[model samples]
Target: MADLHVESTVQDNTDHSPQNNEDVQKCHVVVPTTGMKFESEDEIYSFYNNYAYQMGFGVRISSKRKKPHKTYYALGCHKRGVYESKAESSKQSKSCKTDCPAKISVIVDYDGTCAISCVSLEHNHALSPKKSRFQRSHKKIDSYSKRRLELNDSAGIPLAKIFHSLVVEAEGYENLAFGERDCRNYIAKARQLRLGKGDAEALRDYFVRMQKRSTNFFYVIDMDDEGRLKNVFWADARSRAAYQLFGDVVFFDSTYLTNKYNMPFAPFVGVNHHGQFMLFGCGLVSREDTETYVWLLKSWLECMDGHAPKAIITYQCRAIQGAVAHVFPDSLHRLCLWHIMKKVPEKLGKLNQYKAIKKTLKSLVYESIQSQEFEDGWSQMIKEYALDKNDWLCSLFDDRKRWVPLYVKVIFWAGMSTTQRSEGMNAFFDDYVNSKTSLRQFVEQYDNALKSKKEKETKADFDSLNASYKLMTGFHFEKQFQASYTNAMFKLVQIELQCMLFCNHSLLKTHGTISTFNVTDILRGKRGELKRKVVYTVSFDEVGRDIQCSCHLFEFRGIICRHMMKILIEKDVKEIPSCYILSRWRKDLKHRHYHVINCYEDLKSGGHAKQFEQLCSSFYEVAHIANSQEKYDYLLKCIALAKEKLSDDSSWSVNTNTNTISQDAHIVSEPKKPLLPPAQVRSKGHPPTKRKESKIEQVTKKKRKINVHEANGISSVNDNIYRRSYDFDLNH
Candidate 1:
């Protein structure tokens, strides 16, 4: 069949009237004419595809001929072909052919310039401008869209949101050249390109590059018998350094499956002095067995200079418990109280008086101030509620020592009794990764997330230095902490100080250095009108200047409780004992690891960068002190003399511009071959599955299933809940 060709240009020389001007304007919609020219063949295809998009049809290269001197091409409607039937045994294919006979012919001259010789603007079938952008040839991801998609995908934005954002930017879906599928395909291709060798190889290459740039960047890879990657662990210098300062307690969790290989993301998280989550280490493991966890914990411990946290919190997992016992025997292993309590409804919801039982259980667990009190309350509740037959409850009781706050209050936990910090860390990571992410992309996004976290910590550090809070109690102790602790920690102490208003303490007895007092505290319940009165015992020591509260808030959280504060004020104690002021939470303490640069930092000067920063700090202090002109001039002279002396010493020469190791060069010398990606493994817990569609998706799918607008005199129900309820009442 021969393709039909039409003139691309429509000229109206006699168009002097308004209607004629409108027609001329309508005709000039950027369509290619018979004499249109292009710089290259790609441009020719692009122009025709654009025209096809505007004309509401798809275009394709129908025919092409190439010779030594000339090249010929014919671009036609995708439907301009004869249809052929195939056997049922063959793979099913959808054909869109109706012999449209619409085409444009182009010729490339000796100079390599393409000029349109013939053009067609007609199609045999009906053309819908709204659907043209969906055409195969017309749908192409432009460079701008590609970059935007990549960035949004890296930031863990869903496809629907990405598509909606693009559609909004383009005004409407009809105005967009590419659809959601094209965006998805482009991102998939980008991932493939990013993983040049493979996912495992690319990740190793990235780790190698990072390690070379930052010597303190640590990573360890575990391989299966077949040498395939089984698990991987890594910790940057900042995280390692942070662990040294905030390593008293840690939260370990591995519930999130954030990669294609289905490896769980395990992060060793801790609370910094500022009460922000500090990542100690991270790992991706195929198995959740005790062996795998032991390896991860040992690797993390080694990275952090073999310092095991005093207490570790985790979800209820036997594998983790066993691993902790093996690697950190002396460390207290506490299960996540939140995770255990979250299962209350599932385990006991069907029982009679379930609400009462749940309320009593909560009071029994949280309100108890001592271990014996909790044990007594638990026994009473189990018998009162007839829960003796509940195996889950029995198991929980067996493990109560690990999760119950009163049992663990004697140990320092940085005020955390649950693994919520780890959960928070996981939530933070959700902004950078999703289930469909590949291992390579996960590693890359990890760096981005870490950099963002570092930026937040730096901002917090700056704020702590320049900001201060109003003293609530006007006590010397409050002033002492306000001057020493970070702003976040000071706020916590201020909370205790303010609570002192509700506390009334009286001397019960005195024993030489120790005087026991009974303290009564009035606290408000969550219900607005409810108030509770509780009595606590406080012991004060005049020799040591120490006051211990029976509430044990100071022992557990490193903050003085209201009872202790009240007793101290009664004793006329003007200053807090240095023993009570924890250096771990102090603002002025600095760790060497804080100076260790991460892979994201500038590495041109290598190890000298840390020295440069130290020198800059010293110079800044000197500059701050030299307020007078005479002192400033003398300081400048001293700096000049030091510089001269340093320059004259040949052995002290250091180049600040270049290092022996190029930042971009690959330094890994092992594996001689690219490593194979880890096989998709079935991790512990529920098997990995696609994320459940959101409520918006469910509504959209429902709308798609039944178009109410097109139904016979049918309409969708009122979407507003209040309106729906009102309408229901009216109908009733």
Candidate 2:
């Protein structure tokens, strides 16, 4: 059924308004062009469309195509039909058309210009309200508006702001011929169109390329019954390496909606040597259940070469807990304290002493460092608060070993306290995904986000390699740590060093090679109230040169505790033990750079075949000659010199006017690298205006980050997961 696009009112054909008077008189026909016509079909279309609008009519494409004749390109338009009311006339309502013979046709001349050849300006029936009287003029979002909206979306403009901007651009809401819902729906449809299956294919292709470039780039996709993508798991080379080194303790959190697909994005995170959160792997699950969780956990383990982390942390989820127990029975599973305490007010809000109970519960979680201490504290707090009958408190007590800090203090976490690292993971990719983001948009967004993160890591690496923070303390241990740890870790150790100032240590009894010392901490609070005192027993093994402290800070957090530092100072130890340093956080730890290169997927690429042949020839020759370590070293030096010479060579050196060979020497430039150029993403929509190969765009490739075309599928719970492996070759 034909429908009206917008509101319209009938007018008498005899009316003499300024516009009507002009139309009734000899109508001025603005020709497309008489001499130098437009070359673009869109331009020709635009000219006619504007002409129709001025005549209080709407225009639509009739038939615009090309042929091999003199009129190489032909463009045409016709008057748009209207939706007539039933009350006006039965024939008009049934037909919903005036049968107006108002149309145009343009022919492209041999000069690459278009000239209009046919025009019928007169209409059989009275024209309806300007533009809106047409059957499909309601959603006429111009190219300019779409591009503007796209730019705004990519810039992370809030949707509300985008609406305000579009409305203002149109001058007013009435000019838009649409409400906020229409604009939003248009944006949604646009995004879906651009970010649909092409994006999903793009994501798959990207990971395939990443895996080809590096050895440890791991990814797996589970397909549904129809071979559609169900669940996906992936981890990059650096992440795998990080897992190999620092995956002793892990934090798991993936219960948030990042994309429109409703798939949970779980990130396997751990604490690095420098106390920074390191991502080990990530998974996108269509559903969060025990079987799915199991697959994800097993996939993570597989990527890290079946090496399970000694401990795992997660929120209070029965599915996750069951998965962990089944998959990693040997590894201790801990619960996130943050998630537990967050529900405290809601769980215990009915009590009059809820505030007191909350405070006491927090103190119990943080203060107790031993099983005995925790037990004592829990019993005392519950009794005092009259919570012996509280089911929530009893359940918490029963599950204390999994969540209470005191129970898990002995296990190494590299200083991580909760699964909040997963929250940080969410923040890392939040900028990329929106409520309407599609799978393909996710891929582009994740790539950009990951690149930004790696760039920051590189900057940190530069600081660690070239810069140093000044030492605030003269402690010899501080000097050792500053030399070994990264700048960030050294700063943490420095804080620990400063805290030693308030610590008082005394020697206790010595048993053979083991010497014991008692260290007391006395701290003053902001209100001049002395905080709770803590005394720690430090044990030093003279034979092994190993040190241990009752606080177990090093064992858990990876940093030497204040008590141990005080003891060392008292004993006048010259250096920290070598065993205390972890390599993952070292200043010289090697990391790989993951670069995205343009992979010519088709046979039509320019000059790439020759480049590939040359690369293979050069690498093969080098590998063949450099058989032994000595020969390899010599080749390495030669390669270094070649690189240095290339970096130093200038194309246009300053022409010195000095005598003969020139006595004065010019300053050399910084080191330069031979980097490969990035590939351009295939784009959609209007034919590009620029001549250059479509370069990097804000929304890469075909973009919408769209709201529709969601890939929905489910993997079976009982399906056996086989190990998917790839082979590498020493030769190219």
Candidate 3:
């Protein structure tokens, strides 16, 4: 992106007086120019600065031409680097800023007489309005407004909003001399000054302050041989506690590169009860390698008191895998499902099953419920698709036990399968961090991200501790889950409970205490949905009041699957068996000592909270009054809908209709609209078209198209395809 707008440098009034001013000249060497005589260089420079301001620009003190015993001083536009060749000087200045002929000269003469001259006065760019031109030339924000902006910035306000607020505070748009861009530039300079040079000392200074603020706050920083940062890791006390509660399954991935340094921003994320991404720790490393990974993992493990996660999921990389295996030998290092599926297209492009492979792989990984079933299906796929010879796929199969859902069905992962949470964390920090974000800026941004995530977790914790979630289904077993599970876990359980009603089951086998049922979904699979046909074997220890299903949902997903729930209902098992109630899926995790992080970032977070509440209270009164009027009803409704639509621009839709608001849960009997065709065809704009490529098509090296003509091709004057032959070539 090119910078379209150009500006000239402006300086503030200087204190030194003009050298040729008669205030110091001993009454004889009179001033030659028609400007006010001043005593010192500061006074002379001040006159030039004022002249530059009036001309919509600024001037700087140019170096005086000095000989062996001669001295001369001049003031000119800093953009115009003064030289003997005026053309070259002008060209150099205009190259940086086209059409900006900002040049002025104030020279001290040989007789100690001052001469003021305007060499170049015209400006190509439009001048700022009078109200702001002077202040902008000086680049000074009034002390009060600067303080206000700093206060709001510290409050974590958005930059654009803060600018708008300053505009509002000015009472008039033109009252403020500087633009938003200037305000941003000033803020950047202020932050740079506050952080000092970005180095080990600066980082240590920040960490020391953090430790003083929160005794439990800890950090580990690794430095390179040149005393520069190689890797740094940190975690707060509450975050550590959350890890203790729900860190059994951890997700690791380099979430973003929102810094000038281009550090790998890897965050260790976990799933809270509300299915929100929880930050356990964050690491910024100079590079991705086995050594860096080892150092980061060690720091994280040390912070967690050597309590390793039961499972860790990350994108497949040899360096990360080796480090994980070396450091966390007992923990299951799994492959991210998203990464595996993403790599399939590029890695297996040569295979014949390129088109059907996606569907087959999804079924083989997500649908298959047993290890033996996956083994058989995988082998069959390799044979049918001729994928057995592919080295990449062969390596994947060799490590299937680590990534395939079927093989790890017995381990409890709390339903986490990839660094999708980490990706979301990256997005969460997008509002805070940017390409030019520095170390101090990143710390501030990290606080903002952490605060938002903690707020969500706090909200969920509050709901679990206080509010009662409405039950979607009216069932005793469902109600039991509603009470026992957190809102998020209960939602999953409620979905399974609803699914149990749709399952059509028939007893297939009964031998001793083992019973098998062939469960077929009646409402789904027969239509447009994916087919789900399976036999669920239920082992019932009637004497111990225990039951288990083959789907292993209770064992792995930490939720009772519909298959098992149907069997449990058949067996008249009343409340969820105590053994299946996973505490990790609930807010009430059984940690030795768990602490929830405070949601409010600081005491000043509520600076405008009470004021906003008062406004909301006033609106409530107006809403009540408007509700009584039929005319105001739609208007009030519109306001609410507008608020919702404006609150989240990403999800709100302008085209949402009545059909979209209703659900398919209850069968609504309505007359179907008569089928009609082409009453109104699509507008005659360019019709949508897809460029279909062959299944084997992959991006290869660019090739030029060869146009080989026959040996004796005739060329017509009108035939542009053939070149004209001046003479007979074959005879020669």
Candidate 4:
């Protein structure tokens, strides 16, 4: 049966006069009589609906009859019928129905006009005119309000704020006809319409459209055997192109819950020349197994043109470790130093001398400049602290090569010792996306985050070009770096040059063209006392002007160490060699990817809208160029020829590959049926629980330092925690 509820908008057309004029039309005092005539059934409903609205009741069609010449309709109160109970309902709910006899019968005469034949005017329940706006039949969202809500939503305003604005516009809650829930429901349906068919299909269409805009845009969709989306990876052209330059050391972390589907957000992060975090690529994976990690890594490698990074840093996950080994065999796999250090207090916090043990461990990990030094210190500390029986310590010692700073200092890490770059990237994206963000919305917000990051990079580039830093030292080497390196990198070089004052060196030995010198660094420690003199051996070849330091600061980081600077000054070298100045840190390098336009600019309205935008852009450019008469004539001819060439009657064939998009990302046509959205599953850990803060952060959050107090020959917990956290900063 069709819905019996008749919704008619009530317009206020009050006729005010001392006496009622027969010619004045009345709407609020509509009365149903036995001989009332109407133009059609619609007019009858409008008249009764207005009366019901004014009387604070609802009207509906109680019955209808149709037979050639004898057609009639019966209207009554909405709650005029008896309520029936259903056993199938799990819970009982209140119904508004009551056996009210108030009704009117309208009959269609032979002339096709409707007239009231019967009337009964009596109601069973009381009604309030002020509360009538809340009734289901009377509530409505007008076109102006809907457009305003949509505009606010598109501008990223919160729904609560939108509803508040609407309420304010209507003067009060009673003045507004619709409620917040109604507005929310309407917006939800509007979003559904925008995401045509389904969210997965909308995502696929977005990927295809982006790829069409830029061929360098790459995306891969991994589907399960059931054709459901399992994992997705994508990188814009700018990111892909950036990988060619800064992909030597990468930070990959998958700790963030990125979407409503509970997929892990894994981003491959790198550092650009300006020491800014750069996104190489990112992916969303449903699983954290070795197979899933392997596929994600492989897809990223393909997107970066199969040029594996020299080093990759990540948290200590067994699955990721195995995947990194399998997919990037030649790449140096290093565990994040911060991840291991943050667990120090948790793993060994119960020890009686926990502060002493933490201090010794930090000194062993960070102060040791050589692999043998770290090994010897680690063994001595374990034996001194009697920690040989601790399983966690044993496991960490066994995997020392993957996290120990002294063990992995052979390769350049862009001056990074941990995966904090990935953490910083995640912090940046936290402002735009959340756990409830949909896949399509995630991509759109991801573009916004990239734009914000790029704007910073652009500003940094501008600063590098226009700003200049004064040289702290008068050395020719400092002057040379000031001219060659960026302002940021040059400041680092100047710091090293300034530290040469504290570096005292003496000639050790000479062999052929190689001269060795022992340099002692004397600097104030964190406690404000002179630190113990640490000796470093510097080897300099006069013939090649080559220098090497035992500290390996230059080998691990790109900057030349103070020890080398001391030796260079002693040798009377006027300027540093060009080989020591890395091109990655230079200010004059030209960026090639800046020419590519942003991929998400025209993505809000996908498909034909993008095509229309491109045509509009092309025409605008043509019009701009056709200012002169001769150029205008040439453009007219070109337009005619282009139109003729595109006037083909042949059908355009679209590729319908749904499982995987190629690395080149040839446009994959949207499927006739959209695949179902990925099923929700718990992430790697408890989804609802917030991540616990490490002991160091929690303890030091309120105060950076606390005086140690002895109570019954025991130190306070906060004092011990603060001291241990102090060691973390000292190491850094």
Superposed model 1: Cα runs more than 4 Å off: 1-25, 28-57, 65-73, 89-93, 104-123, 126-142, 157-176, 350-357, 383-390, 418-422, 528-532, 601-671, 683-732
Pick out the ten consecutive residues of candidate 2 with the lowest summed lDDT.
Answer: 723-732
Ranking by lDDT: 4, 1, 2, 3
What are the per-residue Cα lDDT tens digits for candidate 3 across 1-732?
111222323331322222222212112111113344444456666665665554344555555676543345566554445244375454553232333455444555454545555444444444332432444345567855675666667656767898898888778666776788888887777666655555445556667666766777779977655555667898877788778778988888763443556566788888777767778888877666788789999999999999999998877677789889988999988886556776677776666768797679777877776678888998988888877778877878898887776666667777664223225555556556654556677776677677777677667877886866687655567777777787877877876777677776778877776666776643355364745555556566655667676667677667877877777777776765677776676656644324544332232235485575566678668767775578597767888898888777688558856676647546675763222211111212210111112111211111111212222353322222321221100000
How many steric clashes between backbone atoms does each model show?
0, 3, 10, 0
Worst 10 residues of 3 by lDDT: 723-732
Worst 10 residues of 1 by lDDT: 723-732
Question: What tens digits encode model 2's per-residue C-alpha lDDT throughout 624-723?
Answer: 9899999999988988987787666484487675566634346665653222211222222111111111112223322322212233333323323232
lDDT of 4 at 254: 85
Clashes of 4: 0
The TM-scores of all predictions, comma-separated, are 0.76, 0.65, 0.65, 0.71
Q: Relative to the unseen true structure, what is the C-alpha lDDT of residue 208 in candidate 3, on a scale of 0 to 100? A: 62
Clashing pairs in 3: 15-42, 16-41, 16-42, 16-43, 17-40, 17-41, 17-42, 17-43, 18-40, 18-44
Give the C-alpha lDDT of model 4: 0.76
Better of 1 and 2 by lDDT: 1
